[model samples]
Target: MRYPENWVNTKPGLDQVVKKLSSLTSLEFKLTDALIGDALILFEHKFRNIGDILINAFTIVTKRDILSICLRELLNPERTFNHYDLFEFVINVIDKPEEKILFQLEEYAIENPMMDVFQDNNGLIPQACTILKYPSIMYEYMLVKFGTKSRVTRYLMKEIITAHIGKAKLIKFYPSLASSVLMDFRWQELDYIFNTYCMAGVPFEPEFLPLVKTCPSDTVIKCLFDGYLSRLFGFKVEFTLSRVDQLPIFNIIPFTHREHNASSEANKEKVEWLNAINCNQYEPITDTFRRHLEKFRSRLRLNLI
Candidate 1:
């Protein structure tokens, strides 16, 4: 709060101004000219000189223009910058953040001799890859920066594989990536991985036996059974037979059935196939599916309408 006699003529006291601005709520920090003027003055004075203080201000301020200004200033190549928090803050706040900023952060991380940032699980580049939509250039750059055989590259690939898995959901599969990650790491969400591969038409493999043994949710079991059938028959097929306990196969037996000539034969064959496969090693649910089907068929025969 101390003002020199010729404070106006000397370096402007903008640090306190920025500090106060940082504490104000988004709603309170209206983009009025007075505020922008003060921010611009702060930008000019404190940007290169005060690193820690301005970085803190950048973290708290949410306004795009101020953030933009701070980010531009931080990216100055010659500046001895090492604030990962500030780097992450800018990228997270801005939509589709500049690749250059991420590059700069990576450079700083690499230059630090004490810590192997790339190898560190807590490194920001992997997280940054998620935000930047995993550009191939960035991925390749990282691979070369940290040799492919290195633990760091494996970690980066893990991030890439995880991102692909999340995006795959049920319909898509990244075969190479899936194999690479699954063969090495034991993911906690085996059910999700199983369901994704099953629904994506990946044939049953012995490796999946452990997942089947885990006895995942009934819906996942249905996916497993359906996948096995598809692999066996060389054609994609879904069991739309009946719902039992909300499971696709059989749950509550429908009271009456309206018979259709075309689908009756197909349905019968599916049921027959389902029964035949009940004892197969690949069929993890034993006779649960067949038992439900039989129960439903019996209910239909009784004409309980």
Candidate 2:
């Protein structure tokens, strides 16, 4: 980005942008440094006596564009500062070794229908609440609802609620908190997906009718509980990458709710995610996540065998 001859009077804000990037790998650090350095060399030739401090500021369109490209290339590491990087750390489950046991019940054994995935005693929330640098909404929710030392098993069930009710609709039931703390973080992308899609008036499969019918204030659950008729009956899948957005390719199905229809009204949607997968905003897939995902899949296969 070139500064006009008069901009020498303006402060150099670009350096702050570069300084903020904490490259995890040597390659990333070198690339980031090299790019900034090269940009400065060109800046010197292009602008006289601007001083060596370069940082990104929203003041100029060109500089903004350059900063955009530069930070994006850095994978735009989380500015967690003293906060936990949820996306980076959330998937840590892949690193954990899976424990398994094969057991057969006796003919007269009583049925214990509880599924383990539904249990939160060993879930991400408990561990996250303790270590996260900043107290987040989820952490706060955990503390108030489950307490610091222990966790409740039904945490994800609330996910279905938030996904359906959204922060906006929560104003009716939850009111103050909905208008406050519950406002920002996505409980599920339901708020966005419904607002965007409903506003757009997207169509759904006929079988999806049952989901619509069963949808409740805490509803985003109907779609998954559909009878195996959906399995027996062929249906094209609609992919949802997150609550608010869909994957580019065909997705399985998306969840939506009409109310609580709130979230990231920052004019952001799940589709805008660039920092989560890898740090590369340019690539559609995150290389790092793909590696972990493959390992998870391998572990799953071994368990199946």
By TM-score, the best candidate is 2
- Reference-based lDDT, each prediction: 0.39, 0.29
Question: What is the overall TM-score of model 2 with all chains considered together?
Answer: 0.22
Give each model a TM-score.
Answer: 0.21, 0.22
lDDT of 1 by residue, 1-305 (tens): 22356644664434674656655654475644344334434444333343444445544454455565555545443333322334334444565453444554455442222122222223232222212132233333333333333333433333433332232221122334434443233332333333333333333333333333333134434554554454343344555323212212211112222344745644664566555434353544425454544543454446444
Candidate 1 ranges with C-alpha deviation above 4 Å = 1-195, 210-216, 240-305
Worst 10 residues of 1 by lDDT: 246-255
lDDT (10s digit) by residue, model 2, range 1-305: 44456765764466543434432222354334446535533543332233324433321322344433432222222222221222112112212111100011112111212122122122222211112222233233322322211212122222322234232233333444543333344333334433333322222223222222223332232222121111112222222323433323311122121343335421232223212222332433224334433443454357557
Q: What local lDDT does model 1 show for residue 123?
A: 28
